[model samples]
Target: MISFHFEPSSLSSTEKRDRLLKLSVVSSPILGAYFFSTGDLSSPFACPLREFTGIPCPGCGLTRSLMAIAQGHLSQSLSYHILGVFLFLFLVLALLYFSAELITGHPLKISLSGPLQRHKRLLFPLLGLFLLSYHLARLALLWQSDQLLPAILNSPLGQYF
Candidate 1:
């Protein structure tokens, strides 16, 4: 049996800010290369899971999606993987928040410090539903369209997907 714990107290604003900055630094070059690389830009690196299983992972199209966005193809990016857009939005917000924290010396904090803390009751269920729906949609698309997967994987714009 496995047990899981959720403790809001463990969420540290400083750590969040630092992590955001680190991720931005790490993603920059990959994003740049993804944008600049010519066609035939499949990764030299192989996915270990795919190698062992011969099945694509749920995350298979995400890199190509990012590459598409880096290359300024928003429609193709979203088509490759919807979550890539969410990730880009989250990254941009995190970068902005981190930048503000660095400049102001006060990291942004989700102040569940008052009655808002109780709002977790509503927030959790809503978030869960959203994630469930999103994944279901992706799975449906994957099942319905074999071409979709390979199209994303092989697209010249797919270097980022």
Candidate 2:
């Protein structure tokens, strides 16, 4: 089974520092989103998949969702992305856990990966199917609103379609 046990005395100084560094790298974006205002932000680029095919990828609107979350607008965030709240909570929890470990000089000892390995076969396909269906539903809504054709036509690669 894979599990984390915190024990300050279980890790060397180098191990603690290395773990903290990795956690810091992963948590940087969460900090940025919390401190920055989305109103002041503008995108210089579009999603490559969307720019080319005019269909949003699975992660589309995630930035906006994070921004909304940062602004304390949970409903707005949900409107931007259905999965945003879960992602936000996961990041915040991970950041807090790692920060606590760093401050207390504790390291998580993750032992054996059998449990996760056993679940992957069932988990991956379910996740993929959910995403595919969600994307199809989004496309149907856009089509119903008469926005689908325009989106395709305005895309850089749409002329070939």
The most accurate candidate by lDDT is 2
Off by over 4 Å in 1: 1-45, 110-161
User: TM-scores of the models, in the given order?
Assistant: 0.55, 0.76
Give me the runs in candidate 2 sitting further than 4 Å from their true place.
1-4, 38-45, 109-121
- Candidate 1 residue lDDT tens string, 57-129: 5666666766777777789878777777777776666666556555555444644545556665887798678
The lDDT per prediction is 0.61, 0.76
Which ten-residue region of model 1 has the weakest summed lDDT? Answer: 1-10
Best by TM-score: 2
Model 2, 1-161: lDDT tens digits are: 66677775755788778768878876866676666645743332368898898878887777677777888889988887777787888788777777767777766565657777667678869878987887888788889999988888988878886
Candidate 2 overall Cα lDDT vs. reference?
0.76
Cα lDDT over the full model 1: 0.61
**Alpha carbon RMSD to native, model 2:** 3.7
Local error of candidate 2 at 19, Å? Answer: 2.1
